[model samples]
Target: MSAVASVVSLVELLRGNPGSCRWTGGLSPVDLARAERELGTPLPPSYRCFLAEVGSCEVDGTDFLGVYRTPAMGDTLLGTVSGTLDARTDPRFPPDLLLIQYDGMGGLVCLDLSRRDRAGEAPVVVWDPGSADRGGPERLAADFGSYALRQCTQALTRGG
Candidate 1:
């Protein structure tokens, strides 16, 4: 199956039976395009599809970041992807690393924009804050689709 198709299917499955994942509908195309322009790079296919077809979600209790403000959710806006990525709140965090989501237990899930894997997409990695300056980030998946599906599997195991 195509990457987008597979990612969409996974989202469907997770939405149907997500344990603690807070899933939501996809974002509008216009908003996603704006985000891409602001980020200065085209998003990977899986993430692009997810944002355009699945919006924000909290899979396995971890809140995934979204790109635009949703009207349904008022002033308490979580934030757009660009905002989170550009924040660089911590000096230890690499500038090329984009924070996607943070697991409740203090580990952050992020994508490396500096290099793209053979599949022409940035790889996702888990950054541990506890060992902040000691070691390198651990690889999560080759791409966002793989990462999301893995998380969905965990959700099913826990909630299904």
Candidate 2:
């Protein structure tokens, strides 16, 4: 499925279990534009679509970092993308790495904007602060959507 389709399905699943799913919120096209403008860079197309569709949400307690939808724009809590990049102490961190999600710990999932994979999308990689010196990121997905598919599916079906 396309990235937007994938997100739609996930959101649908969340809707079915609102009592358990945690939705931080979602973002509008304007919000996406502002975030890109503020960061001085554009986010990947797939991720932008996801934000437009899924925003911020948690699946079975697994929160996928997303833009804040309500009390909405200009909120500092919605600054996950740039915040983590600023706080990173990794000297070898790439110049175009965009922090996309937090693993609820000290680690993050980032998109490599500087380099695109065979599919023309930036590769998603994991940054574990404790292992920053390991010389490279642990590649998570070919793109943000792929990461979502791999992770969200696992998260939803783990015990089903």
Global lDDT of each candidate: 0.69, 0.69
Highest-TM-score candidate: 1
Q: Residue 6: error of model 1 in Å?
A: 3.7
* TM-score, candidate number 2: 0.77
Residue-level lDDT tens digits of model 1 in 1-160: 5455668777777667655566666767777776776666677777888887777777656567855465776533344464455456666666666667776677677777777766557788877655456677888787777777777777667754
Give the distance in Å from residue 18's predicted Cα in candidate 2 to where it truly belongs.
2.1
lDDT of 2: 0.69
Give residue 130's error in model 1 in angstroms: 6.0
Cα miss at 157, model 1 (Å)? Answer: 1.3
